[model samples]
Target: MLESLKFFILRFDRRRRFFRTLAPAQRILDIGCGTGKNVTEIQRLFPSLEFHGVDLLQDSQVPPFVQYKRVDLEDGALPYPDEYFDAILVVHVLEHLHRPLRLGSEIHRVLKKGGRVYVETPNWISLFIPSLAVDRSQMQTINFFDDHTHVKPWSRQGLYAYLGACCHLEVEKVGTVRNWLRLPGDPFVILAGLVIPNRGNVASAIWNLTGWRIYGVGKKSTH
Candidate 1:
């Protein structure tokens, strides 16, 4: 559709960077997998790797090859042995947790030695980002607290510490999450919003322009 084309040209997607962080692993676990977008994306990117997913609810959308478990991230433990996964993804999951560190501990417990874990969440800037839409109900959330599910926000430094101190993982970061190939479209998207703002796309594009998300890659220590 025409709208879909506009969204692609406008909205910034961070999947490419996240995928690169997970590329080195053979076995991957996605915490808070939701309805299996992570599973589908990973499968499309690297079909040879083993994939597992855990979520608060059941998902029927995933392929047969994926191992899935339903878990309450705060109440129930991640039911995997220590150092089990080669790479783990906690994309947009931590902000929803009441006890995020509990999951972080489990992430460290399940991740293989020297294996990578990629965590992405909204930064403090998410608290103030305004939606471009005139009718607010039509817009996807631009502010972090707009999603009542989000318990807290994460900064680049805070995420770095969360992985290092709580999880005992060696952490790495590059500040904000962005894709160079798509970044050139940001200014045009911002300008387009003034005349013909696609509410959903413009909000997401604005967030990317403002660096609303913070992320880090942590590797479980070998010794």
Candidate 2:
């Protein structure tokens, strides 16, 4: 019931397409999976699907449902065989790398032909957010540099191009990720930001209005 409500408010159409596009996928990979949040939530909807995750985090830090592989994306290739995953997700992880696009080849190598990849990263607008990291502990990521790990920032055009040049990848779509339905509450979120000074959830709504994150999706060529 809660998930359905969020679907309507935060991301109705995009969420539908996200799940619908992957309904036929047999196996999926989440790159830079962090604490396995992506796979954890996805598993609820795809109990029968095989899920895998690769990240620099300790195996114990990730959820058990996923096959977690500890890998440093900067030093070496992903620890996976070619043509393995039917779907791959790289969300908010590329910026941490010094050369963001260096892993494109590895992504192409691991994803199956005709498989799809979804990549999202902080766009140029994310760089312009003011009052970056006021408290140091909270209210950070709204300003891209607040996360010192974010060495490289990306734009929609760059991500779109990376998919195409990343080897046998057919770029399907590129756009700023925004919850158009959330627009109505943006003013309240902005006003709350001034009063409560919380960049966590309050800023999320404002970011949606600004289209702070950009995304691109591409499919590996069968040939």
Candidate 3:
């Protein structure tokens, strides 16, 4: 029951909208596809597409649409042929690994020419919010670092530079999202920041200004 609730929340329609732009026949891979939440959504939105999921642990309840592989990305190689996938999803997984560059290169190795990769990670920008007195914690909430295996928390510049070095992928878009419910103090501040003229600028500024969270879609270069 708990896992079902998680699936519903994670499968937000807005998230699917971003992914549906990929071609329908493309083979999709989801790295660190915990409990197949994102994979299920992808299957629902693009049922005809081939979908594969990999994670450190295997769960019996993974949806029928997903082929599951159990492998520790931190300790071993991705067990697949080169250029195997047409697109890959790495949602909220990179920060938990020590070898992000190695994982990026592996993802590049598995992606066919002109393939796309969608990645989302917690924004290290949230740290800046506390510095600006917009939040109470001097750092991100406990959940941000709760994973014992997490090696690094990446800033936008850090993540982009790291991925760029491993593959010919270019960041096509960059954005932020709020993960926590706003409180009275910070909520009003965030609201005022949005209402101010040049709302995009305000939002971007606040987003970039803090160590919140960053997400991006990148297209693998064909050259």
Question: For model 2, how does the per-residue alpha-carbon lDDT over 42-138 read when each residue is reduced to its tens digit?
Answer: 7877789899998888888999988888888886488888999999999888888876565898999998989999888888888887744434457
RMSD of 2: 2.1
Clashes in model 1: which pairs?
none
Candidate 2 stretches greater than 4 Å from native: 1-4, 13-16, 132-136
For model 1, the superposed segments whose C-alpha errors exceed 4 Å read 1-15, 21-24, 61-64, 132-139, 191-197
**Tens digit of lDDT per residue, candidate 3, span 1-223?**
9798646544443346467676544788888888888877667677788889889775675676788888888863788899989888888788877766678788888888788887778776443443232333224232344335656677777767756776558777665654232222454555675455333333434543353567777777888
Q: Can you give the TM-score per candidate against the true fold?
A: 0.85, 0.91, 0.70
Worst 10 residues of 1 by lDDT: 8-17
TM-score for model 3? 0.70
lDDT of 1 by residue, 25-110 (tens): 89889888877777787787788889888886755755577798878888637999988999988889888888877777788888
**Residue 55's lDDT in candidate 2:** 89
Query: By lDDT, is 1 or 2 better?
Result: 2
Residue 153 of model 3 has an lDDT of: 70
lDDT of each: 0.77, 0.79, 0.67
